[model samples]
Target: MSTKYQLFIEECQELLAELESALLELEIEPGNIDGVHRVFRSLHTIKGSAAMLGLEDVRELTNDLESLFDRVRSREIACNPKLVTLSFRYKDMLTEYLQDPEKGLPQDKTTQILMDLEQVLDAPVHAASRPVESACEDCGSCRPENDKDADILLRLYHLRYHPANKSFDSLDPMDFLSQMQQLGPCEIHASPELVPPLDSLEPSRCVTSWDVILQTGADEETIRDVFLFLDDPGDVSQFREINVDEAAKLRQAQAAQLSGLLAATNRPVAPLPADEDDDLELPEPTESSSAPSSSQPGSPAAVSSIRAPSSPAPPQAASQEASEAEPRKAPPAGGVKAEEIASIRVSATKLDDMVDLVGQLVIVQARLKQIESELHNPLLTSVSEEIERLSGDLRERTLSLRMLPIGSTFNRFRRLVRDLSSELNKEIELKTNGAETELDKTVIEKLSDPLVHILRNSIDHGVESAEIRRAQGKPAKGTITLSAMQSAGQVRIVIKDDGGGIDPDKIFAKAVERGLARADSRPPDRDVLQLIFAPGFSTAEKVTAVSGRGVGMDVVKRSLESLKGTVEIDSRPGQGTTINIGLPLTLAIIEGLLVTLGEEYYVIPLSDVLECVEIQRGDDEPERIAKAYDVRGELLPCLVLRNWYHMGSTGPEIEQVVVVQAGNRRVGLVVDSIVGQLQTVIKGLGRVFNGMRGLSGATIMGNGALALILDVASLVTELEQREVAGTGRNKRSDRSH
Candidate 1:
């Protein structure tokens, strides 16, 4: 595909996302004029862009939707649930078609949406459903003098259109003019002044300008919508509403000009008075015009725009009238200027390549530093240090390019929650917080599935139904808040729901029945809760479409572990449940604590390390490899790396215990020595070693030696399990005695 076509697809997909969001907002707040206008503008731009790209299917479909919202804008057709649902279906279908335009549109879905739209447009909107326009009339200062005046009033508009870029690649100005004609009786006049002589004229280039006089009841903003797809309409088009006196003057002036031109050309044709056409009054549009434009104007010779008055036109007022009308528009801080924001769309593959290149540079820099130290050459050391600084900066910058706000991922769950809530016959509101928290783009992409599973579980099991909630003295509507934040170089995401929390007894009983827990032993609540993450473990008595096959939570656990992240849950029986997840800011490079165990070296993520302390080794064999050590005053769980890896020799007289935080507990890793902290570029072990326990991945050291990166969370979990099994054995032995 051509770059232009790809870009068009990307742009339309983004617009469709915004369209869905607007439609959702409209569903909630039917009177939200801002949302209605937003829906209209998104559709308008998509349709115009599609037409320019020769995507008639998209253009036609979007145009129909745009007309529906246009009426919603005019308050002719009230924004209703039926309209919102139909718009969503259309948005979804358009999204699919854009992704694979060669397949053409799905006729069954398209026809259904169009048929539903027709039904909605033809349905009568009761007075109660329409927004109350006279609410302000009771206020003394707001009442209009003419209380019985017609709601829709005809206005005369003058418009000038000149193509900013004469190239045919951009949108055709004639297409916009045709749209203007549909509003009412419009006279179009084409000026051929810029048209060159036939001998010199380029057939592919357009130089003609158009003048249009449109008499329509549509507001100035509505007219501006015709040219909405232009990158910058103000540069090529001008709109000025003419008052009654100005219209009369313009008509007389235009008639004289036409007469003079006709006589000078020696055409011998009588010039009709402009007012003569006024006899053909343009009838007002019906309550709504939901049909797409049937055809494009073949010629621009008939176009005419109202002439400007002697005074300068108020272009700012005319362009900003729509915004001004929305009294409760979102504040500047809350609104994003998507079009104005300077940004470029880049592919994930390119970013991945850049990250890979940066990672190589870091490895090369490390090797250089190792040589510098070994040779102890002053010049070599200086050069190595400089290269190190530059490489470090480059690495940081490249990794940041992969960082994206998690909000987009968060917004996606809104649709999921909405559909599920309706399916389950519940009323649930999904709220988001700290969406601006940024993480590696790779992390965010992988993060979506886990988040979806968690959210589904929350809606299915965490949040209670409306009847259950009300009986429990809670509001009928349940709320689930998904939030994220950054702290100490780690992104923390929390999925919290205000619903009935998990029951420890039920979880433990299910675990025993599933053979995942001991039937004779009662574990702590925390351990019982951990059973939820076990493979094929579920507490649901019966399977349902949403969940209950015991698949989602385990996937969530494995996915997080693969990302070197952790998840923990906290619950209050009747209050709610909150699941907390911790993830690294970037996965490309991380600060790691390098430690040597016997002949091998390993790197521990610095983010998890709390402190390092020196401990003397004991000569007693059992004491030397004790599972617990006293750090300061507290007895922390300890793992002896040398013994765990089954190294042949243990020669160290003094060992360093690196205390690292794993989930909720702290564990000390005993190693031969501390090799200091360094930026570790993580390298994945190939498929041969995929899912290797006790190791997340590996990194390269300064000496070009491989250092396996410790999966502290996994190791800690293993240690805890061992302790639990040992305790169980001791208890059983005591009962036998």
Candidate 2:
């Protein structure tokens, strides 16, 4: 596809999103001028871009819709609930159209929407376009009636039209003429004489200009408004008011001179008008015509417009593009504000490439620093340190580029909730907070499916019927709140619903029946709630279209785990359930606590660590699998790493314990020593290591060795699944493998 077409597709999608958002807002505040403007702008942009790309079907559809918005914006037609509903349908249709780039919009749907919009607008839909009309009334008056007492002066403004660098293959000549009429009725003449032959012509270049005569009573300022958007950097100076007689004389002299040259060269001159063919009614030729006897006496051989063989005549397609303005460049504010506001759209592929390059640079910088430190030379040390600082800054900025607000992901669920509510016959409202919280784009994409399943579960199973809610002394409407917040080095997302909550007794019974729990087992609330995450586990009474066809919560858990994230569930039987998901701010890089275990390096995510403490010799190493550590008078179970992974190294006389939190549980990790904190880019281990119990990912270190990134949650869960001898009768947790 052409680059312009690709841009159109991307831009169309963005416009569709904006259109949906605006329509939804209109549903809330029908008279919001800003929302109406937003909808209008989005529709207008889609129409112009579709036209430019020759997507006629889409152009026609948007043109009809744009016509309707114009009426709504002018308050001629009210924007009501029916319109909002139809607008959503329109969004859905455009989405389908853009999905397949080869095909335009569906023929049937496009026709139907056009017919419907045209009927509502009380107007006819044209496949091509209409002429622009003067904004002022068509009384043929030169000035406003309110200025009757003032001296009425007719100012002739000479305006010229030129095309941009983009192709103007479909531009109409008379279209811009109508737009110019808004100032007042004006006579337009086209000059295409400068156009080259078809074989030599550059398609993007314009070889045409229009000679316009304005008969407006309005001042130069009002006349200038008609051409404001059409003016480019240098074009503005070409537009100014000329006296009517001088303009007419200028035209006559030029025409006479041209006709004489054409007659002398034995070339046929284009016919001038005996009468104006247009509605503008051009005036009869002045006395100068009688003096020009260059040709036969009765010949009407005065040139109106010279056109190339390949170009369409000016009248057939008026300059349709003058009304289509290029995007505006906002004026710079204070230097700081300008810097803060400037931004450009970059493709995901480009950003990913930058990230990869930056990662390589970081590794190379670390290697250089290592070599410099070994050399122990003052000059080399200074240079290495400076390069290291620059690389660190570049890495931080690169990673920050991957961080995007969660709001865009959150916006998608609005449509899902609306449709689900309708299908389930429930009065449910989705409330969101902290949507501006940022997370990695990769994480957001991975979260989409899981989020969808979670929301489906909430609507289909979490919320109760309206009658049940009222009976329970709650409001008739159920609310599901989706929120996000940034804490530490993690983004926390909470999906909570105010509905019938899970019952621990029922969950325990179900788990036992499914062979997931022992028949004699009596688990606590948290353990019972976790049974929902077991594969193929669901509490829905019977299968329905919405959910409970047997695939859900477990998938959510797996998806989060793949991102090295964790999910936890909290519920109160009569209240509601809230599922909390914790994810790293960015998967590209992280702040880690690097430690050495048996001469091997390991990195633990810094977000999980609460504090570090030293342990003495003798009884420091746990005699059994689970050991209890007293930290500030609170006893926490400590998981010994060297023995579990079989590192095959003797325990040091003194060891360090890093207290970390995984979900709601706090535990300690035993390592030989803590080597402080450093930021590292995580690289995934291949499939061979995927099945291993407690490691998440791996990263390269300054010493040209690989360090394993710890999966704190998985480690905690593994410890929970094992029954131990030492840590106060450690009971194996009921967590799934």
TM for candidate 1 is: 0.78
Q: What is the lDDT of residue 560 in candidate 2?
A: 90
The runs of at least 3 residues in candidate 1 whose Cα sits more than 4 Å from the true structure, single-residue gaps closed, are: 128-341, 377-380, 622-626, 727-737
What are the TM-scores, per candidate, against the unseen true structure? 0.78, 0.75
> Which residue ranges in model 2 land beyond 4 Å of their true spot?
74-77, 111-341, 617-623, 723-737
| Candidate 2: tens digits of C-alpha lDDT, residues 1-737 | 75656677787788898898888778778878679878987886676556545567777777778778877765667777767777787889988877776876777876777666666776433323222345543222433546432233344455555443334564444444655664555666555556667798887666666666555555544444333223232332244444433344435534544555466669966755544443232223334333332222322212222222222223212222222111123223210124554686799999999998988877787788779878899998998889888998998898889888899888889888888987888988889899899888899989898899999999988898888898999999899999999887788999999988889889888888888888665766887788898998877788888877557888998999998888899999879989999988888878899998887889999999999998764454444446676878998787777766765556787878999998889998888888878677789889877677688888898778999898999988777765321142223333212
Clashes of 1: 14
- Per-residue error (Å), model 2, residue 692: 2.1
Deviation (Å) of 30 in candidate 1: 2.1
lDDT for model 2: 0.71
Question: Positional deviation of 588 in candidate 1, in angstroms?
Answer: 1.3
